[model samples]
Target chain A: MGVEGVEPHYQIVVTRDGSLDNIEVQVEVSEQIFSDEVKSLEKLGKRLQTEIKDLLGISCRIKLVEPKTIQRSEGKAKRVIDNRKI
Target chain B: MKVKQIAIFLENKSGRLADISHTLAANAINIRALSLADTADFGILRLVVSETEKAQQVLKSAGFTVGITEVLAVEVPDKPGALDLVLQVVSKAGLNVEYMYAFTRKSGETGMLLFRFDDQERAIKAFQDAGCKLLSDEEVHAL
Candidate 1:
């Protein structure tokens, strides 16, 4: 989510499978302005996955979505979508 | 010369590409050349259109995330070993090619190759020194 002059939109989707909990980070990255020269979208996803693991101590999957694809709440932003309850 | 290429972000859902093409067609934008690089979840569609600015504007208005990138358009002879000659120059110059795609004209002995280099300035210089013919934005649009 390293975009300049524009706010990066993202949403965290948490789910559970049997006994393990999984987290998925969806980031909006359309422009080719990555400082590290990430050529492909897959490589950018991998880099963001590594960063999220380092910061949260929980390995998660990265999903690169189009800008503004994530829904925005009116008052309080609902950044995390918990699908584990379902 | 540098050519303006439109890069679009697309989801991996079906009919997304069709939607983009339909949008462009409805707006009278002609896609001259294009390439798609994708992951499991998303894809980047790079296109050289007849009108870069108009295409970008229309695509954005149509709700597609679009960005314009400057890529080198080299004219390569339409024969064996021609591509190798250009690659040789890039290799000798220590230039890193991020991605490249080829497109041919209906009636021409030379095909066009669009290259996105890590170092644009160095790549341009290398191609120029190697006596390669680069297409300008106007040339690409006309094609």
Candidate 2:
């Protein structure tokens, strides 16, 4: 919990390609969480996924990227990119 | 004993790696050794190139995220168990290798390998003390 009050930014997307069903998620975290922190990031992501599945019943894929690499934001920032076809 | 290696962040999509290699080729940046580690969505392309500055500049300006890290280039004899000996030395010294890649020198007599270690100074000292030959940037680039 030494994140220093930095809330991570993440995104989720659900899509079906041909017969394959998939959900992808991207998490934007500070550089401080890295440098031998990959396992921890994956753990946090899986926890979130479990909660989401229990509530919404959908699984997801997760990715991690730097905040600046994605975009600069003044507030909570955009967190979802749903390109799934209906 | 430390060589500059460029790390490029690439999205896991077709043509991304091709785009990077093409751009480097067009700019005349020669790739000496390379490694790619990836997840399902993204990848980190690590490269030892002829010109680090030029490659970094061109790649960054081309909008491909890039960064530089120092790696140690060691020369081991082109024989069986040569690399195992080096790894043994590092392990005995209690150093960890983040990642590594190897290439045969243009001469084909000796094998050249790049190693990234968190404690580079200690790793270098360990290698040196163990009588392993190390290659400078010029020596590596020449081959």
lDDT of 1 at B112: 88
DockQ score for model 1, please?
A: 0.41
Candidate 1 per-residue C-alpha lDDT over A1-86 given as tens digits, one digit per residue, 9 for 90 to 100: 34342336688999999988899988876544322123555666777777667777779988877667788889888889899965
lDDT of each: 0.82, 0.75
lDDT of 2 by residue, B63-87 (tens): 7657777889999888789889999
Docking class of 1: acceptable
Q: Over the stretch B26-81, how does candidate 1's per-residue lDDT look in tens digits?
A: 99998899899876777788899999999989988887878888999999888888
Candidate 2: CAPRI quality band: incorrect
Task: For model 1 chain B, give the 10-residue run with minimal summed lDDT.
Answer: B103-112
TM-score of each: 0.86, 0.72
For model 1, name the residue pairs that clash: none
Chain A TM-score, structure 2: 0.57
DockQ, per-model, please? Answer: 0.41, 0.18
Native-to-model Cα distance after best TM-score fit, residue B1 in candidate 2, in Å = 1.8
